[model samples]
Target chain A: MPNINTLWRTYQNLIISAAILLFCAIGFITAVFPAVEKIQSLLSDTQQLTDDTKALTAKLTVLNALDESSLRQQLSAVISAVPTDKSLPTVFSTIEGLAAQSGVSVVSVDIEGDTALATASAAKQTPEEKMLGTRTIPFSATIEGTLDAIQHFIALAPQVRRLLRIRTFAITFPSDAKPVRISLEMDAFYQPSPTSLGKTGAAIVTLSDAEQSVISKVSQLPQVSGADMSLPPPLMGQMKPNPFAP
Target chain B: MSTSEINLLKRSGNTLRTLTDLEDKLRVIAWWSLVALLAAGIILGTAFFYLSSRSDQLQSQSAQLGRQIDAQLVKEGILTSLKQRADVAKNALDAARPWGNLFPILSMIALPTQLKSISIDESAHVRLTMILGSVDDAVTVVTNMIALSGQHTIRAPQLISFVIKADGTVQMGVSFIPTL
Candidate 1:
């Protein structure tokens, strides 16, 4: 057996080579691996940021191109058709206006379901209505006139700005010489304003061709109701930090 | 005391030379590996920092544009509302019964007999009461409705009631679904 000095002399080069390899492995594990991992993470984050920037740019471009006045005008027409709330006064006014135009005399108007505005939440949906996902105010009206006037009124009901769908109508002709009495059951549609806007990252969708045509059609509808439906400006004010204290 | 140790066996000349060559090669390989690892670390560090700064710039730009959009939040709300309501209005217009078409048909049907009373609904179902002067008029009414049904103008004609009055006038009540 060799002594320690002899063994060390023989294995010195091999030991130095092994030590270098160990040093490289340690450096790779401690420094290189973490750096590589961080690079990969940063790359992913940068890619996400690039995507967000593109979306925001596109959205800004579209918004800049939009004509606020035109949007407001088109929106006004559409809102007149399907109001955001139950504008009962407009509904009655439209009916009366139609009656006057058709040369018919309005007899009575009755609202169906719960008439109290406070109980709006209690309005129940039928199975069929639930499928349509529509909210409606159902009402019935009676008018008396000549046969021609009655027919004219029926034809004009759905063509006005205050949109009404006639569910059923009955015309009664008296035996003697008298005017015809027409009773109509109808529905007026409304929807509540959206509670929240889309997220900032969401794509802004423009009006589709079909929607454009709808706006065009409604624009041609006679503004019989003439209800003011301008959306109020957003209320902006800061609240006190301690309302109770105040 | 002896300071040096002695080798126990003599090494073969060829084997010792070969071992010396291999050891040299291993030393070269180790040094090069270290250099390559260091270069890789520097390159990765540069790329990481560059990407981090780029990410920050893009994030800042996005936030700026987001603020611009937020400033027009009211317009956004109006646009959204219009989109929603326009869709509803389109559906309503499509689903509305065309009373214009029905009135012309009604006029045609009433041309033969006196249209006393009529009822119509959104589903195109129509109930009508009319006065006929004679039995011939009644036959004419039935045949006319059947012909209209054949032409896809109406469907499933039903005679609900037939009453003969003392004045020799016949009153007829009928129901059918119009194809409008």
Candidate 2:
């Protein structure tokens, strides 16, 4: 057998090559492979961040261009048409105004459905209402007037700013010279305001032409006012510790 | 030198040359592997740094935009709310069956004095009862209705009842769906 030194001299190049290749494999396994993976993950994250930035910037541009006063005015008009809540006073006054303008005498007015005040919790919606994305307050009214006056009231019911849809109406004519009496069932539309806003990166779109036309039509209709249009007086007295005590 | 002696010397030189060639090949391979490993490391490191910096820059930009949008929260809320309600109102308006158009049709068919009573329902069905002066008036109303139906103003017209009252006045009840 050859001595160790002799063996080293004969196989030294092979041994050196093997050792260098082993180092390359170990480096790949421990450092290079992990670094490649981390870089790929970072690339993906950076791409997502870039997209988010672009979206947010676009949203910011839209928000900046909006006219606050004009938006408020339009919003007010829309709210008056399909109010955020059941504006019972507004509805009642609107019916009264319609009666006065049409020269009809109101016999009775009755509201149907759950008359409970709307709470902070979400309102329960029927399947039809959910499908339409609107809640309705149904009411019926009986009025007596001439035939021409009744026709005028029917024509004007759906056009008022406080939007009303006449669901059913019946007019009965008497043989004698008595005024015609008509009973009408109507639906007043009201939708709750959005509970939460969308993400900051979400886009804000402007109204479409059809929507603008609807607003224009409703805005042109006559608006009615109730006597108590003022906001409730602010609490001037000291805050009570036990508000529910009384 | 002798021929056999010359051949042996040449063979010994060839053995040394083969060993040297083997060593050169091994060294070349090791050097190339080292160069490749270093190049991969440098490229990956540079990419990592670039991606990290870009991510940070984008995060800062998003934060700035968020602040700008936050300042107009009220206006944003108002606009969003208005758009939502406007969409609903538009749908409701479109769904409503307008009776205004039906009135003109009725007036054309019969005088208001003759129209004793009328009822309109959600299905766009109109039931009109009229007291006519004569049978000729009733025939004229029916012909006018057929003409209106042909013009697509109404559809499915039916004379529900025709009665001559004791006072000799013709009472007619007509039902039809107006295409409003």
Predicted structure with the largest DockQ when compared to the true one: 1
Residue-level lDDT of model 1, residues B38-132, one tens digit each, is: 89888987898789889889988999999998777777777887888888888677666867567677765665238888898666789989998
In candidate 2, stretches whose alpha carbon ends up further than 4 angstroms from where it belongs are A117-123, A226-246, B1-15
What lDDT is obtained when candidate 2 is compared to the true structure?
0.80
Clashing pairs in 1: none
lDDT of 1 by residue, A105-141 (tens): 9999998966687534566766645554556788999
Can you tell me which runs of candidate 1 are displaced by over 4 Å? A1-12, A119-124, A234-246, B1-15
Worst 10 residues of 2 chain B by lDDT: B2-11
TM-score of chain B of each: 0.83, 0.83
